[model samples]
Target: MGKLGDMANKAKEMAKGHPEQADKGVEGAERMVDERTGDKYDAQTDKAADAARRSYGSNSTTDR
Candidate 1:
């Protein structure tokens, strides 16, 4: 795996123990992107962010 892949795996492991924080991080990132893009991709970004949040053991209200 490449360095990015390695970092991803490490993050997943850390998320296992800090799911809430991970979810917050994902949401924060999504919000930042949406703001930067003027909400153009808000729907898609929310979907992906929800998935990422769930992967870390957190359940997001936006996940449906």
Candidate 2:
């Protein structure tokens, strides 16, 4: 749980100043999950990305 919190914080920071980096982070995280779970959690990646964006308060449609 602590690690998850830390990741959330990092994602928020990335989304705040560098959305592209946040996107990359999401992709990387997804890839890691796929590698670990044998692609069993493909749908969860989008949820993770959305959560990260929301954590940063940058989930808006407009570019920030």
TM-score of each: 0.82, 0.55
Pull out the clashing pairs in model 2.
Answer: none
Tell me the deviation in Å of residue 57 in model 1: 1.7
Candidate 1 per-residue lDDT, tens place, 1-64, comes to 9999999999999998988788778878998999999999989998888788777777556543
Question: Please, what are the lDDT tens digits per residue for candidate 2 over residues 1-64?
Answer: 6999999677577688887666667667767887899878766765765676666666543221
For each candidate, the alpha-carbon lDDT, in order, equals: 0.83, 0.68
Residue 53 C-alpha lDDT in model 1: 75
lDDT of 2: 0.68
Query: Candidate 1: TM-score?
Result: 0.82
Q: Against the true structure, whose lDDT is highest?
A: 1
